[model samples]
Target: MDGSCDDVGGERTALEDVGVLLADQGLSDAFFLERGLVKYGDAEAGNLVVVQVDEDGREHELVTGAGEAWLELRDAAQAEGVLLEMVSAYRSVERQAEIVRGKFLRGLGVDEIFAVSAAPGFSEHHTGRAVDISTPGYGVLEEEFEESAAFGWLEENAGRYGFTMTYGKGNAYGYLYEPWHWVWG
Candidate 1:
């Protein structure tokens, strides 16, 4: 009852072939990345699951599995006086593309953008399993959120809900430390 998405193929081997993809539109539509498996397009056709995380009717969709766990985590945090809010949730390919474009227009080179942002099709947001969380008194998506009481609470308890902070101050992934970004297992 977790969730589902497109399944491409199950068997994978180091390919001796490497070639250029003129475009990845169809390729992406035919596959998806998941926590532990590769998904083919048909899996998402009728069973792709998402859920709204906000009461504002914005349809802030998140992968159903993560959405359910996030709700539980949020409630638990609230009970402890630590309120968590979703500032950014699932993003479509189009939206991710726009974000990268905007960053380029703002003078960020591709390398710099990739350091802080994922390049469209390569974004975690595409899977609907990643979220940018925030709380009261600090700006959404700001590093300052790291110093908030909410972050402290999450640091101590998020793993209980199958969540993990993706980028830490000096860890791996070659991306900027993103304390606000959490991905569900």
Candidate 2:
């Protein structure tokens, strides 16, 4: 998070805003570099489409290409008796900051939080291509998802739909092995 933060509509303004937010959260300007993290630009609002509406009425969205690919992947999995559910998709930088702030309020340090969550403007979710997924009978966002039939199906077939697991065991980014996270291009 060194130089600038980018949103579809604005770069300099978004950079300033994200910088202030990170400062408020006590993050250093070199946070991303220190963690070997990549900064992601926000998706264009017009390019996003609702991919799923959660039980709590929250809309999980992705950029059109990824959203369409996700739907196709889910349908293909269902046809094979593997159900995939969207846990999270296309998070905003603001929402990411709130998540980080919540972790801080809960007494977690930035190091602990970064192990599981990306710094606000650096999350892949901000790009509208990443998704957190789960299946029936598994806890959402849990590592146990790696043991599910859905995970097996994804490992075998998600690539055909242009999705790949982003965070794996011992990932270079230093995040925990997040078997539930994937990104579509």
Candidate 3:
């Protein structure tokens, strides 16, 4: 697969090659990346379901139908001795903006932050269908996660729960490869 991890029977796929999963069919109209996020607004957000992240009960919200799959995936991993944890999930536009604002305060320009964090409305977290996962040893959202046992577990089993790793090594999304960021399809 070289730097690109998405391969389809000898061919490769990119973001444009697939549909971006949203919180619900209704959220398709949220907002786009270039316009920049001014506010967070999802009509369906009110009905989002909050689920326990793991046995310790960290809570995270996702669209109505995702909680069960998350639990199922967690249980599956636990069976294999992996303690799954959530670093982030269901972020709001305001939260995303705050993250960007914090980065800027620390000297990162908008373009620099955009390369790593999606501008408010453009973030998958807006849909509540995306989650940044973590295992204790690898830290959160680090490239080193790719070398962990948890990463291998996800690569092998996440699909059965309808989860997919969105960014690959040379992905076209411009975001860095995120072995920890997964979208529930």
Candidate 4:
């Protein structure tokens, strides 16, 4: 299949194409590109964002929730000498749209941009379960998170917290590789 062309055999929408972009960026697992999978806010109200400090003393964020599992994960990280901080949590679809537009101005083409930029209803950020982690001094964590220690740590342990890398290795999705971003189901 051509990475730039739409998946004719699949029912994926343009929004999912954006998810492919995210996967290529390393924001999460590529599997997220699968069609019809619900993310963040479904009927469970379990979407949240959490922050953490890396060995470099830099702050980072991931999409998560304020549930007990999240707290437990935080506590575990703290016990291991990891400084976890809570950054922004639960973003609205409007916020996600703003991000999509900004990405376009940054030189992302229509296909490279999420379909949400054109239609807000398809945004993963709207689910509030997806987060744009903050890599202080690194601009948006989307592209550079891979080189950050905070993101690496999360990659190793986020699954234990019910959080997973929405775009990453072994994923067929084509988003760029982002070491800093993550999502909770």
Candidate 5:
């Protein structure tokens, strides 16, 4: 990935580009920008990218992981019959900005907004090192997915593949506890 805004045609680069841009803009303390995609649980830097077929049957290409951690994780989940599926991945910086703006408009305070939205150029999706996985028939990150055998298997084995949960209980950094999200280290 070029990770440049030009390639994205002013749509803002992927989350990785946003992270880099934010670092250049001096918001380093707010969040650490991710570089590439990885499994949803890897602690290494980067955003989660995934490929998903939406309910509309549209194939969406997501930027995630620097290599094959995502594939391995997906395979592991499948081997266990966990029924894993990706919902969203590799969000562009422009899209992230829009999400932030939407949240702001929806009454999220400045701090609250930043807590969830990457301040442009400071996102991980640019690196294609992150992923969002869920069980089939589950709407997004449903509670069942969070507690399902697939999730548990990942939690127990993702680290071996350099993947870690991006957010979960007791995590004080970046967004809320998203059981469905992971990153490759």
Candidate 6:
């Protein structure tokens, strides 16, 4: 992901039609530049592998490298008596726009929406390397997950498996603290 102003949509296989994707949700090129956001190309659909199927039976997929790392990380955590589960992974640029649009329809302002959700093409989820994780006995995607043993375990051990928490208190990107969001390099 980089901050280049190169045409977001072209013959480039790595990038998406980000301009149209954002505009559909009422965002503009200025929004990205004003926030100093980095653009993340969505991973090729074929490059993803199913990592898990949640209680709701929705499949979670990640890029092959990330999928392998996630499995290893989960096993290691289980060995240490920590249960890790994936709540989200591998979102597309279209899905990101839908999320933003949904928030807007729910009465959130653009600033409010971006505080928790990245703009289309800016979310690491598009790269298939970022994940939202939770453990048993906690509400999914809630801030309370930060208080769980899983968060502590991840804080202490996730780096060994190549994952790092992306949004913390007062993060530079101005997003709310998301202790459960992590990305594998």
Better of 5 and 6 by TM-score: 6
Model 2 misplaced stretches (Cα beyond 4 Å) = 1-26, 43-46
Answer with 3 or 6, whichever has the higher lDDT: 6
- Judged by TM-score relative to the true structure, which candidate is superior, 1 or 4? 1
Question: Which is the leading candidate under TM-score?
Answer: 2
- The C-alpha lDDT values of all candidates are 0.65, 0.82, 0.68, 0.50, 0.57, 0.81
lDDT of 5 by residue, 109-162 (tens): 646765555565455553456567777565576556676777888878889888
Q: Residue by residue across 1-185, what tens digits does model 1's lDDT show?
A: 01111121123211100001102123232232322223322122222344544676666667778888988999999999999988877776556656655564455654576568664455666677777899989988778999999999999999999999977896454577888999887
lDDT for 23 (candidate 3): 19
Residue 113, model 4, lDDT: 62
Per-residue lDDT over 29-145 for candidate 2, one digit per residue giving the tens place of the 0 to 100 score: 486777677766564334889989978899999999999999999999999889999999998887887777566545676679889988777888998999999998988899999
Pairs in steric clash, model 2: none
Deviation (Å) of 146 in candidate 4: 3.0
The 10-residue segment of model 2 with minimum total lDDT is: 1-10
TM-score of each: 0.70, 0.84, 0.73, 0.51, 0.62, 0.82
Question: Following a full C-alpha superposition, what root-mean-square deviation does model 6 have from the true structure?
Answer: 7.1
User: Please, what are the lDDT tens digits per residue for candidate 3 over residues 19-117?
Assistant: 121211122333333243333465435557887555677678988766678879989999999977877888776666566545644556545765688
lDDT per residue (tens digit) for residues 28-56 in model 4: 42234364444433333343444545467
- As a TM-score, model 2 comes out at 0.84
lDDT of 2: 0.82
Is candidate 1 or 2 superior in lDDT?
Answer: 2
Tens digits of per-residue lDDT, candidate 6, 43-126, equal 444499999997888999999999999999999999999999998999998788667655654557667888888877788899
> What lDDT is obtained when candidate 5 is compared to the true structure?
0.57
* Rank list by lDDT: 2, 6, 3, 1, 5, 4
Q: Which consecutive 10 residues in model 1 have the weakest lDDT in total?
A: 13-22
